[model samples]
Structure formats: structure tokens, C-alpha cells
Target: MGNINPSLLHVGSTLGAVFMALMVIFIRLKASARPVTLRKIWIPPLGMSTGFAMFVVPEVRFPWWWAVTAFLIGWFIFAYPLMRSTVFEERDGLIYAQRSKSFAFILLGLLLIRTVLHEFINRYVSIPQSGGLFFILAFGMILHWRVYMYKRYTRMALPKAPIPQPRG
Candidate 1:
């Protein structure tokens, strides 16, 4: 915002969001029994990408109508992901089992923002001092989960096959 224009910011942020979305979606899709499908691939990325767009709102002081409009636009686009399907076998279910965990993370964040619509999660919007603690915590979570996910995905420690009895 210091030197960047809105259009540039928009494009940059949108692209960045898309890139991250792809990474996260890839992680989810790799957990599948089948190869990744375009339709399924887009869903996680769409939700994540929209949420990422919010970071690009320059100075964080949005004009009232524009802010509300942005909210509704993103809301409409991502709303469907909030609900679960008891019927559709196509959808991911269970925590970290399918893509459900990613969706759950997204919806939880969106719901938190909805609760704090008048303000953000923190009281102060324009303040940046030390985010080390946050980064440290995030790092810990990533490390813990990355190990677990890797293990789970690879079935790292299955019991060894019992030795076959000698056939006389």
C-alpha cells in the first residue's frame, strides 16, 4: 500500500492466493483414491483464494459500501462449502481423512470473521511489531501436522507381514 496501486495489489494478491490455493488443494487431492479432478480441485482453491483476497484490501480501511459488497461477493462464492453433504459420496468427510479438514479450517475462519464483522480479530487493525510468537506457533503446528500427514499418507508403520509357515 505504501507504493503499490489497487489494481496491482488486486492482481498480485489474487495470483498469490491462487498459487497458495493450488498448493493446499494439491495436498488435499493427493489424499484421494482417484486422480485429481478439475471440479473437485477448484472447490478448495476457490474458498481459499477468496479468503486470501481479503488481505489485499489496502490500509485495511475499506469504504463502507465496498467492504460490504466485497463481503457479499466472497460470501456468495464460498457459501456452499460451509455445509456438509450426507448424501454425496463424492464429498470429503472426516478430519484430515479427506479434504474435509481444509474446508473445516476455511469455514471456521470465515465464521470467526462473520462474528467480528464490525472489527477484526484483534482490537487494533494497523499495528505491526512482533509476529514471531505467531510464526513460532504456526511453525509448530505445521511441523506436527506435516509429520502426521506424511505418516498417515504413506502408512509409515504398518505391522510387518507374518512369516509364511514352511510348507513341507
Candidate 2:
């Protein structure tokens, strides 16, 4: 990869980000179309966990404090909007994710923020390290968001007790 051009890398990563954004939107729509399940709620974070292998690469390593700070930022800050936008409702004895009007905008805003942060962070670190840090951040966001979704799904999925009838 010694021959790789900087401008090309920029263009490629930009395109990749756009593609990922589109995929996320597409997946969200498809997921909403189906009844929410515990399996579905848990799958994303589990699958995303595999990305941690990138840390094995020396170029991607960062200080433990950096990792912790990134994760906390994602957990406390980035996950908030996602949790708010995601709501599970029982419909016809099945749980469905309620569509939020602000979801797309929230995603776009996050992507913009991440892109800007990526540019800023890249100046201070190698591309691989930056990627790893952002990966940790994203993992934290997804983990917390998925946990919230799982809790909501289970709550909605549980059978409700009937109200007591008043005796005349």
C-alpha cells in the first residue's frame, strides 16, 4: 500500500462513509418492517464486537485512557439520541419499533459530527489509530443503544396483567 495516494484515500473513505450511511438507513427500514425480537435487538452489537480484532494491529493501538475516554463519550453522549429515537410498541400482540420522525436527521447529524471529528483526530494520529479510536467509540454507542433496545423489547414483549374489575 506504499503506492496509495492520499487524495484517493480521502475520496475512498468518503464514499465508504456514504455507502455505510445508506446501508444503515436501509437496514433500519427493513428492521422496522418486521416484528421486533430479542434476536434482532442483540445481533448488531454482537456482530460489531468482531471489529475489535483490529486492535491487534500495532498501528491501531491507543492508550488505555484514550480508549476509555472515547468509549465513555460514545456511551454517555452519542447513545442518548439513539435511545430516545428508538421506541418499541406492542402491536397486535407483537412488538414493533415505532418510527421516529427525527431518526434520519439524528443519524445524519451523528455522521457529520463523526466526520468532522475524524478529520480533527487524524491530524493528531495515524489513520489506523484514528479508525480504532472511532471504532471503540462506535462500539460503545452501539452497545449501550442495543442494551436499551433489548430492555425495551423485553418490556414490550412481556404479557400484561389484566386490570381488576370494580364490584358494584
Candidate 3:
């Protein structure tokens, strides 16, 4: 295989991350315009599960410790803010993802952090390995956030039990 240029790879990955961030923002806006459903709540992470296939490539494999650490960091640190910023509301008897003022800023912040961390980690790891680690991190974040949302959605969607009335 031909040697790859580090500079080109860096630029390409950064651009790709930026493009994805923008798409997330656009999709969120569109999604908010309609009623949210249980199917919609679960689709993203389930669809994202397909990305686990990347591990089948030898170059993308990383140590299990690194994967665990990345997943934990994403779950404990990153997911918290995302969960807090994402909220749901009911309007006309349908649930919808409430528009949060902080959601966009949080996404931009995460993108910047990922870009900087990618530059640092690439010095010590191959590009594919770094991508794998980052992928784990992102999956953890999305999974945790989605689970939280799922729980909240179910609670809101469920019909409430009526309290027993005392005999007059």
C-alpha cells in the first residue's frame, strides 16, 4: 500500500466532522418541526449500530482498554450535557423534541473538542485506530443520550393511572 499523507488525512477528517455537525444541526431542526415518535427516538442509535462493522478491518482495531476508556468518557462526560440540553414537550397530544437554546452550541463545542483531540491522538496512533476510538466514544455518547431520551419519552407517552376517590 502507498504511504498516506498525514496532512491530507487531518484536513479530510476535520472537514468531515464539520460537515456532519452541520447535518446534525439541520436534521434536528427538521425533526423538531414534527411530532416525535418511539420509532424516531430509537432509529439513530440502531442505525448507527451498523458502524460497528468498521472493527472488522484490521487497521481499525484498538486495545480493549482504550475502547473502554473512550466509551466511559463519552458516556459520563459528554452525554451529560447532551441529555440536559435535549428535552421533550407535548403539544396537541403528541410528543416532540423541544428546541433547546444550548443544543447547537453544545454540538459545536463537541466538534471542536473532537477535532483537537483527533490531532493530538493521531500523533501516537494510526489514523484508523484513532478513528475507531473516536467512533466508540461517539457511539457511547449517542447511546447514553438516546436511552435517557427513550426513558423520558416512554414516561411521558404512557397513560397516567387515575387515583381512587374517597366515598362521600
Candidate 4:
């Protein structure tokens, strides 16, 4: 296994990863900084930041499928459901969560794509790929974002907390 610098990939080539990351950031900022009375604004952005930070992690040699399996597990636990839900309102100043879900999705997709291509398709596809310890962290981040979103969706979906009628 080898370390891959994200810079090596053209900004356009990994547009999915880049776009999702940006959305994650933008959504968190919008959700957290607003006038809404959100219970936990720190959740969503933390996930995103963690995932993005994974890109630069040091190298570690691991089986190719091991990487893919790890990523899929993370997504199943965090990314999938978070992306499935839609945001309707923010109790606090938090941006809608699902809007940022794509970021996690795109990121996972990139990792998996790179892993598979490097292992199997590289001989034919002729495209650059990123690998190493960074993927482990990136996978976790993708899950964390889902956790953050899940928290929000869970609260909204199953709540007995008296909807404190907004004080006019």
C-alpha cells in the first residue's frame, strides 16, 4: 500500500468527492449559524471534517477487499440512512443534514472506486488512484456524518419532547 496525495488527482476528476465535501461544509455552516434553536449543531460538521481530514493520513498496507469491506460497513452504519432522510426544519441553527449526505456518499464512492480500480481495473482503465491509511479514516468520517444526521433524523422522527411552541 502507498500514500496518495489528493492533490495528485485533478480537482475535476474527483468532482463527486469534492462536491460532497463542500456540501457537507456548506450545510453545516448554514445549519449551525442560523437563528434556529438546534439542540446540537456540532454533530454534522464534525463528521464532515473527520472524513475530509482522512485524505492525508499516513500509509498502511492492507488487502484490497479489506478496504472496501471497511468502507461499506461504515456506510451501512452511518452514510446510507443519513442520505435517505430529508430535512424539513432545524430546531437549532443547523443546516439540513441530508443535503450534506451526498458528500459522504461521494467520498465513500471515491474510496471504493479507487480501491477496486487499483486492484482490478488499473490494468485497463488507465486512471490515477489514492490509497492507504487515509481510507480507513475517510470511511469512519463517512459514518460519523451519518451518525450526525441520524441523530437529527431520529430526534425528528421519534420525539416526545414537547415541541416548545415558539415564543412570538
Candidate 5:
């Protein structure tokens, strides 16, 4: 449609490729046996915030309902599955998480679905509006995932109750 910008496709594809590469590295690092720390759990959200900021435009006028819908969809599609699949454990006073590789495949599938939706939406909406929608969607998913991870990490890292001493 007339609203579609040819350059937007190039930019989105390039960004998607870079995101996929980073995700691969992220998955590998998370899958390692290193103890999970508050810092580690916090990093992804911080990085995602930066990415989200890039797509935000002052001129974009997206509807509140659309944003809410996008956020809910992102939460259910991305965050819920990720939270359910992650395996957390406590060993020797350290918290560790076993990252599921299947999540990467799931992410890829979601990305593909988003890409197709973007193509359809771009024909009807301005690029900034679509970009803003995507930003909110990703922000919601990452925020939910990080919050759950932080809770899980804290719960696992808590000190165990000491055994009661027998009366002497």
C-alpha cells in the first residue's frame, strides 16, 4: 500500500538478524552452569529497554487499546512460555537456571509471525505506529520475563532454615 515504506523493510530485517545473533549468544550463556546472580537477571531487561527506546518516536500516535492488546499478546506468547520453560535450582547455596533451547525455536517462530503481521500492518498503518506497537510488545514480554526471573532467583537464593538443636 501507499503507506508502506520500502526502507522500513530493510531496517527491520537487519535489526532482526542482529537480534537473532544476540539471542543465540544469550541462550548459550544462560544455559551455562554459572551461578545465577541479581546482576545477570537484571541485564537482559536493561538491554531490552535500550532497544525499545530506539523504536519510540515522538510523532507516533498509537491507540491505548492497541498498546494494551500488544502487551497482553506479548506477555502470553513470549513471557509465559519462557517462564514456564526455565528450570531453576539451588545447589551449594547458589542459584542456577537451566535455559531451554526450545525457547530459541519458539522465539524464532514468534519473530516469523510478527514479521508476517508487520507486512500486513504496514500496508494499513504508518511505520512509526507499527514500530511503536512492536516496542511496547517487546517491552511487555521482557519486563514480565525479568520480573519472574528475579522472583525465582530470590526465592532460590534465600537462606535455608537451620535445623533445630536437640535439647542438651
Candidate 6:
């Protein structure tokens, strides 16, 4: 324990987060407005849920209220901005989405916020509790963002009603 360096841990985490943010920025830059499928839209939430399940320990005790609060905060603070930053358009018979640069910045901001909060929580909470809470927070953000995207895509994909023909 005496040999462990807290600054090193913080530096490593920050570096990893910066790398991820850079990757996201690169991906966003290369991504163009394209037609999206239902299957693709559902993948994020499903993946996040699966990851949450994998991280969850059956024996570790977690506060239910804390999880709920984290989830709600993630949903409102992170997910809403991400969803709003995504621009959707209907072209021809397909639904297309173009995520703005602000989306990447918002994601980076969320990552930074989560990291700071995790470090703060680590001061008073056990590792298991902090990890579990963070997992729940990420799950909520991804779930809400994907669900909103799915709904928006489906609504935009719906067939428009044909105009009524006037009497000849």
C-alpha cells in the first residue's frame, strides 16, 4: 500500500479517457449523414445493459437509492444533451442522422465529470460500491440516449399518409 501512487492512478485514468475522447472525435469527424437501421439503433443500449450485467456482483451490497439517483442524474445531465446534439433528417424513404461536433464535446465533458465524481466518491465509498454506481450511471446514460434515438428514428421512418385526391 505504501508503494502505491495515487497520482499515477489519476494520470493513467486521465490518459485513457483522453485517448477515448480522441477516438470518438475522430470517428465523429469521419461519420457522415447516413441511413440508420433499427438494429443498429438498438445496439448501444443492449451493449450497455450487457456490460452492466457483467460488472454487477451478486454478493456485493449496493445502495438502491444511490443507483437510482446516479441513473437519473446520468439520464438528465449526460443523455439529454447527447440526444439533443444529434440531428435527424428524413431523406427519400430513409431516416438519416448526423451527429454534431458538440456531441463529441458533450461526451468528453461527461467522461471528465464521471472521472471527477468517481475520484470524489472513492474517498468515502468502497471500490465495489463506486464501481457499481458508475456502471449504473453509464447504463442509464446509454440506455436513455439509445431509446430516444430509436424512438426518433422509428417515428421519422413511418410512412406519410397520402394526400386525399380532390374530386375530378
- State the C-alpha lDDT per candidate: 0.40, 0.86, 0.91, 0.50, 0.74, 0.75
> What is the full ranking by TM-score, best candidate first?
3, 2, 6, 5, 1, 4
Candidate 4 residue spans exceeding 4 A from truth: 1-23, 33-62, 65-127, 131-137, 161-168
lDDT of 4 by residue, 1-168 (tens): 346554464344456555655675566546544432334445444654554444343433445675676566556554554455435465454344434445455545655554554446335322332333334535564556555555765676564676678778
RMSD to the hidden true structure, all candidates: 12.7, 2.4, 1.3, 13.0, 3.7, 3.3
Look at candidate 1 and tell me the lDDT of residue 86: 9
Instruction: State residue 118's C-alpha deviation in candidate 4, in Å.
Output: 15
Query: Candidate 1 lDDT, tens digit per residue, 6-123?
Result: 4564455445544654665566446554533334434543443343344355544434554444445444433434333101122242223434655646644643443344235235
User: For candidate 1, which ten residues in a row score worst on lDDT?
Assistant: 127-136
How many clashes does each candidate structure show, in the order listed?
0, 0, 0, 10, 0, 0
**Candidate 5 steric clashes:** 0
Cα-based TM-score, every candidate: 0.32, 0.91, 0.95, 0.30, 0.76, 0.79
Model 2, span 56-151: residue lDDT tens: 888789899999999999999999999999988777888899878788888889889989998899899877788888889988999999989988
Total residue pair clashes for candidate 2: 0
Model 5, span 1-168: residue lDDT tens: 356576876487648755974775586555557988888878877877776554455645677899899898888776786677677877787778776777666667667777788778778877777877777787788788888989888777777789999999
Instruction: State, as a TM-score between 0 and 1, how close model 2 is to the true structure.
Output: 0.91
lDDT of 3 by residue, 77-119 (tens): 8899899998899999999998887888999999999988998
How many angstroms is residue 37 displaced in model 2 relative to the true structure, after the best TM-score fit? Answer: 0.5
Candidate 6 lDDT over 8-91, as tens digits, reads 755775687679678867865655455778887777677667656644466334768888998998788778887888778877
TM-score of 4: 0.30
Error of 2 at 35 (Å): 0.4
Q: Candidate 3 — which residues are off by over 4 angstroms?
A: 1-3
Q: Which should have the higher lDDT, number 2 or number 4?
A: 2
Mind sharing the TM-score for model 6? 0.79
Candidate 4 clash pair list: 20-103, 31-93, 31-94, 31-95, 32-94, 36-92, 37-91, 37-92, 38-91, 38-92
